[model samples]
Target: MAIPPGFLDELRNRVSVSEIVGKRVKLVKKGREHSGLCPFHNE
Candidate 1:
């Protein structure tokens, strides 16, 4: 099945990257973006 156009854009506008990633990882605010250690790899 194909997704309708604008659906992802609308979802992204309603949701935030930090909000989703923060649940599983510790994030730090870095200017306009977020930074965190990778959860899947040892860094």
Candidate 2:
């Protein structure tokens, strides 16, 4: 199947760790960034 063009680039740019983690953790705004527990893996 053919994937949509620029889809990967868009995903990389938009899929913030905070956005993803916020769904599963308590996220807080830290200055210009967001912080939260790692959702996809551990440090």
> What is every candidate's alpha-carbon RMSD to the true fold?
1.3, 4.5
Q: List per-prediction Cα lDDT, in the order shown.
A: 0.94, 0.79
Overlapping backbone residue pairs in candidate 1 total 0
Best by lDDT: 1
lDDT of 1: 0.94
Error of model 1, residue 38, in angstroms: 1.5
> Which residue runs of candidate 2 sit more than 4 Å off their true CA positions?
1-11, 37-43
What TM-score goes with each of the models?
0.75, 0.44
Query: What's the true lDDT of residue 5 in model 2?
Result: 100
After superposition of all CA atoms, the RMSD between model 1 and the true structure is 1.3
